[model samples]
Target: MSEKNQRAHDLRMYFTGFGLAVTLTALSFLTAILQPFGPVGLFATLAVLAIAQVVVHFRFFLHIDLSRQAREDLQLILFTGLLIAIMVAGTIWILGDLMTRMM
Candidate 1:
């Protein structure tokens, strides 16, 4: 494709991802506020939506696809995710332990 067409395509993909992220966020908020489900269910729904938004951001905004050119970026993304998970888990563990000690 021509340079102009490629640019347009990329812009459209970015916008599409943005739209999807917004929609998912709205749905998550609505589900939580409306109390459409119990607490556990709401948590599950929110988690799913959050994960989907992450995927949209990765694909559209970060342009991190499975192509050969994106391999290094993909590895970086994976490493970032691992770091985040570890931090989150550690925080939760520490907070829970503190709460238990307080009790």
Candidate 2:
């Protein structure tokens, strides 16, 4: 495609991503305020929305994809996610243990 077309395509993708992100966020907040679901269902709904938001960010904002060219980027993101999960879990575990000891 021509340079102009490519730029337009990129801009469209960005706007689409932004719209999806905003929609997902709005849905999350609406769900929280409306309480349409029970406690467990509400948590599940929020979780799904959060995951979809991540996907939009990866696809549009970060331009990460499943193509061979994007494999390295995908790996880097997965590794970072893993590290973050580990750190969060470890912190939670330590806090839980401390709380239990105090009780």
Candidate 3:
């Protein structure tokens, strides 16, 4: 494709990603406020939307696809996510332990 066409294609991808992110955010907030699904249901809905938003951000904004070239980037992202999860879990565990001791 020509440079012009490529640019347009890239622009479209960015716009699409932006739209999806915005929609997901709005839905999450709305779910929280409306609580149509009750507390537990709202939590599940928000979790799903959050995951979808992550995917859209990676695929569109980050330009990371399933292509061979994107594999390394994808792996890096997954590793980072794993590290974050571990840290969060450790923090929660420590906090819980502290709270129990206090009680």
Best by TM-score: 3
Instruction: Give per-residue lDDT, candidate 3, residue 82.
Output: 99
TM-score of 3: 0.87
Model 3 lDDT, full chain set: 0.94
- Model 3: per-residue Cα lDDT over 1-103, one tens digit each: 9999999998999999999999999999999988899888988999899999999998999889889998998899999999999999999999999999999
> Which rank order by lDDT, best down to worst?
2, 3, 1
The digit string of per-residue lDDT tens for model 2 on 19-97 reads 9999999999999999999899999999999999999999999999999999998999999999999999999999999
> Per-residue lDDT for 41 in model 1?
95
The model with the greater lDDT, 2 or 3, is 2
Candidate 3 residue 62 C-alpha distance from true site, Å = 1.0
Q: How well is each residue in 4-71 modelled by candidate 1, as lDDT tens digits?
A: 99999989998999899899999998998998889999999999999999898989888889999999
Clashing pairs in 2: none
Clashing pairs in 1: none
The 0-to-1 C-alpha lDDT of every candidate, in the order given, reads 0.92, 0.97, 0.94
User: Between the candidate structures 1 and 3, which one is better when assessed by TM-score?
Assistant: 3
Comparison by TM-score, 2 against 3, better one: 3
